[model samples]
Target: MTDPADMIVPLLREMRAENLEQHEQTRALVRALDKRLGGVEDAQKSYRQALTADTLLSKLVTGEFEERIEALENKVRELEGHK
Candidate 1:
């Protein structure tokens, strides 16, 4: 009968190689997912900032509702001068 150790050696080496290949493929997939998630997170942050900036700009434009704000300020100044 053939030596059992000799018969098992080749089988063990093949299994090790397959395991290594699977491990490398899994690592690659994880890296790809990480990169995609990073991009999504960055995009979300940028969009939030842009929306905040838009809201601030809208408030600034609309907060100054009347064109007579300067006249109102001058009238207040005149009243303060009398006091």
Candidate 2:
């Protein structure tokens, strides 16, 4: 009594609408993830810069300490030679 073609047309329209909605949702999720990823990358860069500064400061302190030690040793050698 009912036509199969008529039934198929309504079902196809429903499927098309659902597909469009899902595509929009996927696009929104991708945009949110991209924004969050940018923040993470910025934080990583800042951390690397801090590490580099710390390393440089440590090297400068160590160099100063080494120079002071050498000066003390030279003074001790001079005093001993005089005696």
Candidate 3:
């Protein structure tokens, strides 16, 4: 009969090889996930920049409209005083 310890060596070698292969696959998956996460982060930054620009433009336009309305109201008050 074959020695049991001699058989165990080959089995251990096979398990070690399989474990190495699985470790490489896990590393590849993590790299792919990291790449995808970078893309998502870039998109979020672009969206945030666009939102900030839009908010600034809205505030400026609103300020100009308010100024024009105030001027018109002052003119109406001046005309009433003349009458």
Compare the candidates by lDDT and give the number of the best one: 3
Candidates ranked by TM-score: 3, 2, 1
Query: Local distance difference test, per candidate?
Result: 0.93, 0.99, 0.99
Put down candidate 1 lDDT per residue, 1-83, tens digits, no spaces: 88998889899999999999999999999999999999999999999999999999998887776546877988999999999
TM-score of 3: 0.90
Q: Which regions of candidate 2 are displaced past 4 Å?
A: none
| Model 3 stretches astray by more than 4 angstroms | none
Error of 1 at 67 (Å): 8.5
Residue-wise C-alpha lDDT for candidate 3, range 1-83, written one tens digit per residue? 99999999899999999999999999999999999999999999999999999999999999999999999999999999999
Model 1: lDDT equals: 0.93
Q: How much is the lDDT of residue 3 in candidate 3?
A: 95
Give the per-residue lDDT of model 2 (tens digit) for 31-69.
999999999999999999999999999999999999999
Over 4 Å off, model 1: 1-4, 66-83
